[model samples]
Target chain A: MIENAFYSQEKHGPYKLFSLGNFELEEGGIIPDCKLAYATHGKLNEKKDNVIIVPTWFSGTSKDYESYIGKGRALDPDEYFIIVINQIGNGLSSSPHNSLPPVSMQSFPKVRIGDDVRAQHRLVTELFGVQEVALVVGGSMGAQQTYEWAVRYPEMVKRAAPIAGTAKNTIHDFLFTQTLIDAITSDPGWNLGEYRSNAEVADGLKRHADIWAVMGFCPEFFNQEKWGLFGVESAEELVEGFLEPFFQMMDPNALLAMAWKWQRGDVSRLADGNLAEALGRIQAKVFVMPIDTDMFFPPTDCEREQQMIPNSELKVIHSLAGHFGLFGGEGPSYHGQIDEHLKALLAVPVSESIVEQ
Target chain B: MIENAFYSQEKHGPYKLFSLGNFELEEGGIIPDCKLAYATHGKLNEKKDNVIIVPTWFSGTSKDYESYIGKGRALDPDEYFIIVINQIGNGLSSSPHNSLPPVSMQSFPKVRIGDDVRAQHRLVTELFGVQEVALVVGGSMGAQQTYEWAVRYPEMVKRAAPIAGTAKNTIHDFLFTQTLIDAITSDPGWNLGEYRSNAEVADGLKRHADIWAVMGFCPEFFNQEKWGLFGVESAEELVEGFLEPFFQMMDPNALLAMAWKWQRGDVSRLADGNLAEALGRIQAKVFVMPIDTDMFFPPTDCEREQQMIPNSELKVIHSLAGHFGLFGGEGPSYHGQIDEHLKALLAVPVSESIVEQ
Candidate 1:
C-alpha cells in the first residue's frame, strides 16, 4: 500500500490515498490502481481500539463530512480515532473520473455496497491494524455501508447507526436511483460519459438536480417553503443556485456509478434473498435512524429492517428537509437531532449491547 | 367555426374539430387556425341545460376518458350531453406536433388552463348553445381545467368536481412539473423539440416515466406492492410495460407544453394574487376531491382551496395509488369512490347549491 500525505485535507478534508493495487468489485470487473481515499482525525491510542468509522454518502466526500466531527460532538475526535472513508466513485477515490485509461469514464467497473465495505475493511484492519470498531455510523448511502459493515463483520462492529437509509433498497428507491442514472446518460452532452469537461453535460446534470429538488427534499419542505431556511428566497433559486451547481461540479460517470451501487444496496443477498436472516447476522447494537419525511427511504421501510436485526431500534429522525437532511441542509435542528441519537447510541456500553457467539 | 366529423372516434374517441380561427394564448403568441378536438355522448337537450364537460388531463386524450361515461355511471351519457374536450397542446388539438409551420413544434404558442377554458367556452355556447352546464368535472391537469371553467364562467358551470389535483398549483407541485419538463428537454434526441420520431427520444421518455414511477405512485403504494393489482408480476414490468410504452407513444413537445401549463395553474391571477378572493368568486357548487395519498396534489393542498370556495366540500379520495389514482389505477374501488362523490354532487339541486347573482 502506497500511503501519502493528506492532499485535499488542508482545505477540504484530511484525505489520504491508501492504494490497494488492483481491487476487485462485487460486480464483474477489476478497478486498476484502486485506492480508497479517507480522512482521519485524532490519534490512535496505544491499544488501537478507540476507532469510529463513518463512510461517506452518495456524492459526499471525506472533506465534506468534516462538519460532523469536533470537540464534544458525538463523533468527537478528542477521545476516539475518527475516520471518514470516501466510498468508491465519489470523485475523491479511485473513481471513474480518476481511474486509469483501461477502466475509465463510462467503462468503469460497477461497484456495490459490499465492495465499498470490503475496501473500507481493508483500510481499517490492514492500515491501522484495528481489530474492533467502536462504532460505525453514516447516513443515506453511507448508512448503506454501515449496514454492510455490521452484517459482514458482526464481530468487528460493536455498535452501528444507519441513518436515513434502508438495509435493503426498495423497488421504489431502486427506480428512483435509475432516474438519476437515466438523467445523465440521456444527455447528448454526456456523450456516454466521454465529455471532456463537466460543463459538457450541464443539461443532464441540471436535470439530475431537478429530480433531487423534487425527491431529495420532502414535500412538506417545499409546501412550507423551507427552502428559505437554506437562505434562498425561492425554490427556483435553491435548484439553480444550490443543487444544480453542486451536481455540475461532479463527473457524470461517477454519479452513475454511485447510483448503480445505491440501487443494488441490499444485505439480503448475504442470506440468499432472506432479508430477515441477513439482518439477524448483525451483532451490533444498531440504531436505524430514518428521517421522518424521507421520501426515498421512509421510516416504514427502515422500521421493517430494524425489526429483523438482533439488537436494533428504529430511531425516526425529524426533518422537513427529508432525504437531504442527511447533509444538515435544514440547519442545526437536523444535525442536533442526529447528534442526540448518535450521542445516546455511543454512550451505551458496547460490551453490553453486542451479542456473543 | 369549421366543424368536422369525428375521425378517431370509431376506434379511439368521437373526436370532432372545432376551429377557433386564431386563438390568443394567455402566455403571448397566437395559434393561427387553432382548433380543439372533442368527443360527445348523448345529445344536447332542447333546454341545453343538461350539458356536462370533462376536460382531458396531461398526456390524456378524449378517447382515454370514454370509460368514465357509460350507463349508470356518475357521468351517465344516458341522461346528459357529455363533452370530453382535449385541452390545447394535448396533441389531439392544435398542439406543437400538429400546428402550422410558423407556430409548430418548438415555436408553438404557450397555453394555459384559462386559454383551454376559453376555447371550451366558445364550443359550448356557439356550437352546442349550452347556457348552463350541469357539471364540469375532471382530474389531474383536467382538474386544472375544471377549476378554470368554474372560476372563469361561474354561472355557466352549475357544479364542479376537481379530483386528485389542486386549483392553484403549490410551489411543491410547480417544481414537480418542472422535473417532468427537464426530463424530456435534457434528451439530445429532443433536439430542442424537433425530434423526427418519438423513438429518437426514447431515453428521455423513459426517464420521464421513471420520475412518474417514483413520485406519481405513493411510497405506501410501492411498499405494499399495489402494482401487483395492475397484473404486473414485478415493479420493473409495470414501468417498462405500462409507463414507458405509454409515454413513448406521445410527442415530447406536446407533453412539454402541457407540463408548462400544469405548472402555472393558479386562479389567484383573477383576484390580483388573492387566492381566497379568486376562489371566493366561484358560484358553482364545488366538490374538491383530492386523492388521500396523492404526492402531486396532497389532500391538504386541495383542502385549503376547498375551504375558500363558498359551497365547496373537501372530499378526499381514498387510494394509495396517489395522483395516478385519478386514472383508477388502483382498480374499481378508486373509480367507485370517485363515482360516488360525482353522483352525489350531480344529484344536488343546483338552485339551492348556487348563490344568487
Candidate 2:
C-alpha cells in the first residue's frame, strides 16, 4: 500500500515528537508508547513566562497555525513562544494512522479531551520546563483543548480564549459528531478501520465533506453565494474545491478518532457530571468567544456556558462565515476582531500568587 | 433475488395504483410509464365538495398517515373524502426500488417537488373527477406538495395547511438534504444504487438515522431525556427503536429521489424565480404552521416564508419534539396544540368567488 502523504510530519510541519513512554487514557485504555507531535515558534524568554500553547483542531496540523500566529497577529510568535501541539488522532501525533499493534487503527483506545491536555502538559513541563502557560487559545477542537487546559490545570493556565467550542459537548453536537463518524465507518472501504489505502475510503471522506459544508457555515453564507469569495461559482464547486479536498487528505480512522474525542468533550466528567462545578474550578481569565451565526456553537450556548464560569467574559464574533470565521479564511474582517481581543486579554496583569479556586 | 417485503404495497397498505401511461419530468427526463400508489378514506359526497387531499412525506407511505388521520382528528376521514397520495419515489409509488428498467435503481431519473404535485393533480382531476379540493393538508415533504398544489392549481385548492415545510427550500435545508443523500450514496454496499439486499446499506441507514436524530428534533428533546417517555432507557435505545428501524425499512435510492425533490422544492420555478410571486399566486386559505423547536425548519424561517403568502396565517407549534412534533408521536402532548390550530383552520369558511390574486 502507498504511504499517505497527509499523515507525514515532514510535508505538513516542522514538528518534533515527544515520547511519553507509556500513557494511560482517561477512558480506561493504554498506549504502550505514546508520542505527541508539536511545533514551536519565536523564542522562549529567559523567565519562561512568554509561553502560549495552541492545540490543533480536528484534521488540522501545527503548520496550519502559521496564518493565525505571525507578527502583529493574535498569536504573534515574535513576542511570545507559540507552541502548536497537534492533537492525538490527527495522524501527525501518535494516532490510529501511525500507532503500533496494541494501539493501532483497529485497536486504538478511545481518547478524551482530558487525555490531549494531559499529554500537552507533560510536553510543556518535561521538555521545556515551563512552569505556567501565559495564555492558551485556539478555535473549534483547539478551543475544546483550551477549555480543558483552563479547567484541568487552573494554576498553570493564566488566560484562555476558547473560540467556537464549548465547556461541554452539547447533545446536539454529540449527535452531529456521531453522524460524521458513522458516515466514514459506514463506507465499505472502511472495513472497520483496516483499509489498505486512503483511496479505498474516498467516498466516505467526500460524504464527510458534504456534512461539513452544511453544518460548518451560516445559511447566509451559501444563500448570499459567498462561495464566490473563495473563487468558486456554485455550491458544487464549493464542495469540490474547499470541503472535499480538505477532508480527503486525512485518514478516515484518524478523523473518526478525533470525532470520538470531540463528541465526548466535557470538563464536567471530572466533577462527576456536574458542569457548573467543573466550570467553577477554572482560575484562568476566560474570554469565551463564539461566532454569532455558528450553527454548531451558537452565541446563546456560548453565553450560557460563560455565565457559569465565574471569571469569564462572553465576546460574540459576528460573521456570516459561521464556525469557519475563527480561521479567518473568508477574509481579514474577523481576524481584526480576534487580534484586538487577544491583545486586550494579554494586557491583563496576572496574579503573583496562584490559589486553588 | 429475494423479494423485499418493505417494497410490497400489499403488506403495508390498502393502496391502489394509478398509472400515467407516460410521464415527463420538469428536469428534462421521461419515465416510460408512471404510477402513483394512493389510499383513500371516507366516501366522496354527492357534490364531491368534501374532498381533502393529503400527500405522503419523504420516505412515508399512505399507511403511515393513519396516526394523523382519523375520526375527530385534524384530518378527519369521517367529515371528508381524504385522498392520501404517496409521493413519487417512496417505494410503493413509482420509485427507484419499484420502477422497471430504464427508470429503476441505477437508472432512475431525477424527480422534483413539482413533478409529484403534477402527478397528484392528474390523479385528483382525471381519476376522481374532482372539481375542487376543500382542503389540502400535510407535514414535511407532504407540506412541500401542499404548497405546490396551492400555487400550481390555485383554482382547485380552496384551503391549504403546509406544516413543517416552506414554499421554497432554504439554503440550510438544501444543504441538510444534500448531506442526507450523500450519506447513503457513500455506502460501498450501495454500489451506485444497485445493492442486493437492505442489509448491504444498513450502516448508511443507521448513519442517516443519526443525522435525523440531531436535525429532526429540538436539543431539549434529548437533553431532557424525553425519549424516556417512549419507554426507551437511553439515547442508544431511542436510536434502536425509533430512528434506526424507522428508516431501515425504506430503499436508499427511493429516499435519495425524494430528498432530491425536497432539496429542489421551489415553487418560484413556476413564477420565473420569484418566490413571492409564486407564493402570491395561492388562492387558498393558507395556514403556514411550523414547529417552534424544529432545527431544520425553524419558526423564524417558516414565518419569513409565511409573510410572502399574502393571505396566510402563521401558527407556530410550540413543542420540544421539534420537526417530529408534526407526527404527534411525543406522547400526544403536542397533538392537542396541532388539533386546536387545525380545527380553527378548518372552521374558516371557503369563499364562493375565486379571483386571481
Candidate 3:
C-alpha cells in the first residue's frame, strides 16, 4: 500500500516535525525513522519554568485542539509555552497509512500510551532541555497519556488534568473499542490493510462513523436535539455531514493501530495490575475531569480513579455532547467549564502541592 | 439464497404455523406464502376472556419467552391462555432465508410493526375465531407490536403493557439501529444478503453481536462486573461465549429485515406524526413499563408516551440489565417487577377502565 497524503501536512496544514530514528515501542515493535507531528504556541521563558504540554486524542490531530488555544483562552498562547503533540498512529505522526515498508501499514508498530509519553518525554527534556513541566493536560486518549506522564515522571510534572478519559481502561470500553476495530477490518476492501485507497474501504469507514454517531455522543444530546448546535438539523445529517467525512477521509489501518493501544491503556501496568498502587505513586496535583454525559468515560469511572490518587479532585464537566464536547459540540457553555477548571488547576501554587506530597 | 435450518422449527423445536397466502404489507409490498410461527399454552376459555398475547423481540423467537410462562407466573399458563407469536423475518417465520424466489432474501418485503400486528390479528380472528382479546403485553420490538395492537384495535385489547419500548422510535434509536444494519451490510461476505450459509457472514454477525454487547445492557452492568453472574469471568467471554453464539446462529437477511422495521416503529404515523393525538385513541387500560437504566428506551422516553395515553400509568422497572432485563439478565427482581406490574394491570376491572375511557 502506498502512503496516502490524506493526513499529511500539505493536506491538513503545516505542523512542526521531529524524527525519532527507528524508535522502539513499549509493546515491542519498531516504528522505523519514527516521526512526531506537533504544533506550538507562546514561547518558553528564560527559566523554561512556564512550559505546558497537551496531546491529541483519538482520531485527532494537533489542529483539532486549536479551539482551546487562542488569545485569552485556557491554553492562552501569551501566558505559557504550549505544545500540542500528535500521538503515534494518529495519521500526522508515524502511522499505518504513512510509514515505510518493513514497519509500515498493517505492520506499523503497536504503540501503548506509555510509548507516546516517552516520545513526548524526549521532545520535552532532550530537545527543549526542559527539566520541569508546569502542567500536562489532555482529553480522551490524550488524557490517558497525561496520566502516564504524571505517573512516569511525577517529579517533573507539577500538575495534571486528564480529561474525559480513564487511566485504567474499563472492560466495557475495551469491548467498545473492539467494535470500532471490527468495523474496518471486517470489510473486504480492507484487504489486510493493503487497500490502494480509503475509498476502497468506504463502506467500512462509514460503518465506523455510524458507530461513533451512536456512542460518541450521549443519548440526551440527541434527545434534546443538540445536533442542531453542530449545524445538523437531523441525525442523518449529523452522521453523513459531520461524522462520515471526518472519519472516511482518514486511513482505516491507522485507526486500528490506535484503537489497539486505546483498548490496552492502563497505567496500573506499572504496579503489576494494581491501580491504587500505581495512582498512589503520583506526586503531581491532579484534576480528573470527566464529561458527565460521556458514555465512553463516564464521571463515575473517573471519580473512582480520582479517589485512588492523593491530592487529586474529581472535576466533572457537564456537556450534552458527551465525549465529543472536546470538539465544541457541547455548546459555548462546555468550553466555559473547561476554561474555568484549567485556570484553577494552573493557579494552584506548585510549592503547596510539593509540600503536601 | 437457501434457507438454513438454523432457525427452522426442526432445529429450534416445533411451533404452530398459520398461512396467510399472498399477505399484504403496511409498507406497500407482499410477502408471498406468509407464515406465522407461534406457540400457545393453556386453553381458550369458552368466553375467550382469558387470552393473553405476547410477541417476540428482535433476534428472539417464541421459545425465548418460555422463561416467563408457567403455572403461577404473570403469564400463568394454568389460568390465562398465552400465545407467543414470532415476528416476520424471524427465522422460523416466512423470512428472507426461508421464502421462495419471487420475494425472498434481499427482496423480502418491508414490514412495519403495524403489519405484524395485522398478521397476528388475522391469526386471532380468522384462525381462532376470537374477537375480544383479554390482554396484550410484550417487550422491545414485541412492545412496539403491543402498542400497535392497542392503537389498531382499541376495543379488542382490554389491557396493554409495553415494556422497555416507546410508541415512537426516537431519532437516537433510529441512528443506533443503523449501526447494527451497517455491521452486516458492510461485510463483503454478506453479498447483499445472498450468502448461502450464515457462516459466510460470521464477521458481520460478530460485529452485530459486539454492538449489542455495548448497547443491550446498562453501563452499570459492566461497571459492576455483573457478567460474573452470567457465568462468564470476563467481558471477552461474555461477548464471544454469550452474545456471539446467539447472533451467529441466525441469518443476516432476517436480522436486517427486523432492524429496518424496528427503526421505523412510530405509532404517530396514524395521525400525521402527532404522537399525543395517536396515543390518545387508546381505549385499553395501558401500563407503559420502562426499565430505569435502559439506554435504548429510557423511562423518560416511555413516560412521555404514557402521558399521552389517557388511561395509562407509567410503571418503572428497575434493572441493572437495562433492555436485556427482558431475558432475565436483570436477575430475579427483574421478573418479579414484571409479574407485579402485569398483575396490577390485569386486576383492574375491565368495565371500570371502559367507563374511565
List ranges where model 1 is wrong by over 4 Å: A1-7, A43-49, A351-357, B1-7, B45-47, B352-357
Q: Order the numbered candidates by TM-score, best leading.
A: 3, 1, 2
The RMSD (Cα, Å) of candidate 1 is 3.5
- Model 1 TM-score (2 dp): 0.93
Pairs that collide, model 1: A9-A13, B9-B13
The true-versus-predicted C-alpha distance at residue A219 of model 2, in Å, is 2.7
Write down the lDDT that model 3 would get.
Answer: 0.86
lDDT score at residue B173, model 1, on the 0-100 scale: 82
Best by lDDT: 3
Report the C-alpha lDDT of model 1 over A263-356, residue by residue, as the tens digit. 9999998889898998998888999999988888989889988999988888898988888877777667877887888899888787743444
Pairs of colliding residues, candidate 3: none
Model 1 DockQ, alpha carbons vs. true complex: 0.66
DockQ of all candidate complexes: 0.66, 0.46, 0.66
**Candidate 2 - chain A - TM:** 0.96
Q: What are the RMSDs of all candidates, in order?
A: 3.5, 3.4, 2.4
Per-residue CA lDDT of candidate 2, range A47-140, in tens? 9999999998888889877777788886888899999999988888888878878788778999889999999999999999998899999888
The residue-by-residue lDDT of candidate 1 on B101-157, one tens digit each, is 788788997899999999999999889877799999998999999998888888778
